[model samples]
Target: MKPTGNTILVTGGTSGIGRALAEAFHARGNQVIVAGRRQALLDELAAQRPGLVGWPLDLDDPASLRRLADAVRERFPALNVLVASAGISRPEDMAGDCWDGFDAEAIVTTNVLGVLRATAAFLPMLKRRPHATIMATSSSLAFVPRADFPAYCASKAFLHSWLQSLRHQLRKVPVEVLELAPPYVRTELTGRGQAGDPRAMPLDAHVAEVMALLGRQDHPRGEVLVERDHARRWAERAGRYDATFVAMNPD
Candidate 1:
């Protein structure tokens, strides 16, 4: 789908990749709506971008998602694109006795369930447009598991699978499904340690690659591996990806 002149809503637009995408879309002259749970952040984004709309949405809550759908229909009925960029990452030590605690649950609820909620809520609106598209953010970890961040990886893997299936199912519809699989990048979601890590791509560089990828008519079957990186390529090396992961994390 063409990037410009479309009305788009990006969930988790308060920070990280979501915010960067919102800014990019706004700059391209699209009607961009930034949705997130934080009202203050939404206000800040609106203050910065004149035509941008900021909507407070909590994807974790189904009722809230439903309400958001109604709001979008009433306020921005021409909405034709959704960027499921809202997500969370946590080091899930499943070996620990407290695996059932809040952190693990929060990760699942926000990363996995939240995507599902947003998709279902806005699907009807997307259907209204003749050339709509849904972009789901997967990750390099979706292909290669980081043992320590198992929960986050699993959620992304599930989304990747779901997007693949959704793409097949929507073949007859105007709505297009695209999966964006990013490698580690310099962003707040990666934690401060990842900020200084040489392996992480600069935030601007990562988003620029993604923007170029999205501009193309070709939608990658399962993933769009942004720019070449050893770690990212190794993540998809079939059954052998594990050995590469171990080598990188060797103690």
Candidate 2:
């Protein structure tokens, strides 16, 4: 949050927005720890960057997060920022004959419960710092559901509401809470093809905008929203919710 001189831990830092943010912070001379499930990727990233620490983390497993918490507490006692960027997305069609709750459960598990767990694990330490910050990634679709990805949109919607209460509760604690509601970005979150999708915003481009936002402290209501995300994010306020939902969900 300070742009530099703070220790930060970024979950899902092996790829996508998480990796970009970790690298951006590392470039700013912050002590960065990238937590991910891939040991090899973590090792490779750390090998390429001397000060970028990579620790194994499995968001679905509580024991794994516990281990990560212990490691961070012992090694980086000054950690003041947590970027809970780990998440998954899946398209589901409830009308399908094979429709079940499997994909929905996974989405809620990682996007909803996982974020809560990560926050619980690090919030105490964050509270100890005078200028601590908690940032979690949501989605622009949270404001208006995408019919194809019902569960994913719902998961992000949950975070959007949860973060408001979290920010209010922590307001007096003086720890800033930010919700990063990114628009459709070119990433492997949905699968390999999304990374090459021409319609998706470039990963680096989105991260660049986000970094600029962070540096400027331009977030309103602790929402670090990019320009592209504004339309969908404020669709309801703009009297365009129904139209926006139809546009995004048109099959």
Candidate 3:
């Protein structure tokens, strides 16, 4: 996927990695439309960045996603990049109270179902571009599940599977599906208290690497894992990787 000279739509652009990516592309001379659930945040983004467009969006609802699609088609028909980055993450334990179960549902609905809905809505418009790119934000947990956030990990794993299937299906089309699995990042999603965790990577640091990866002509699909240790562990020994994850978090 080319870095600049393309119209892009980044979901969840209000904050976190999504915001960083939107700013990165905008700095590189790309027309960026930042979409999220909060109008106030959108307004703030628009106010802060000249030529940056912001649209209020709710990813969980298909109707809202379709409406956003229609708006995009009408306004920016040449949009070539669709970044499905808007999602929520929460620790969920099935054995806990009702809130825990609710947390699982909310995470799955937003992370998995939201991506599916948004992709279906904008797919037709994306095909019109020469080299369209569909980028979804997965997680390192997708490869190795984290016991604390069971649903979050599973949802990201589902995204990895879904994007792989979508990439195959779009082989004949102009669109290219890319799954970006980030390691723990210092974002609001991780909570303020967890930001300083040694395992967590800085958001700006990760975004820089992502920008470099996306600039390449031959961007790899399926799962693009970040953070050296995770990549190395997964690459060197598949059996060991599985064993480590299972051992660390026994069911």
State which candidate has the highest TM-score: 2
Give the per-residue lDDT digits (tens) of candidate 3, residues 67-140. Answer: 88889999999999999998898876676656548788899999988888888888888998887989999887
Worst 10 residues of 3 by lDDT: 227-236
TM-score of 1: 0.92
* Tens-digit lDDT string for candidate 2 (58-134): 99999999999999999999999999999999999799899989999999999999999999999999999867999
Show model 2 residue runs off by greater than 4 Å.
none
lDDT-better candidate, 1 vs 2: 2
Ranking by TM-score: 2, 1, 3
TM-score against native, each model: 0.92, 0.98, 0.91
RMSD of each: 1.9, 0.8, 2.2
Q: For candidate 3, give the lDDT.
A: 0.83
Give the Cα error of residue 229 in candidate 3, in Å: 6.8
Pick the lDDT winner: 2
Could you tell me the TM-score of candidate 3? 0.91
Error of 1 at 124 (Å): 1.1
List the global CA lDDT of all models: 0.84, 0.94, 0.83
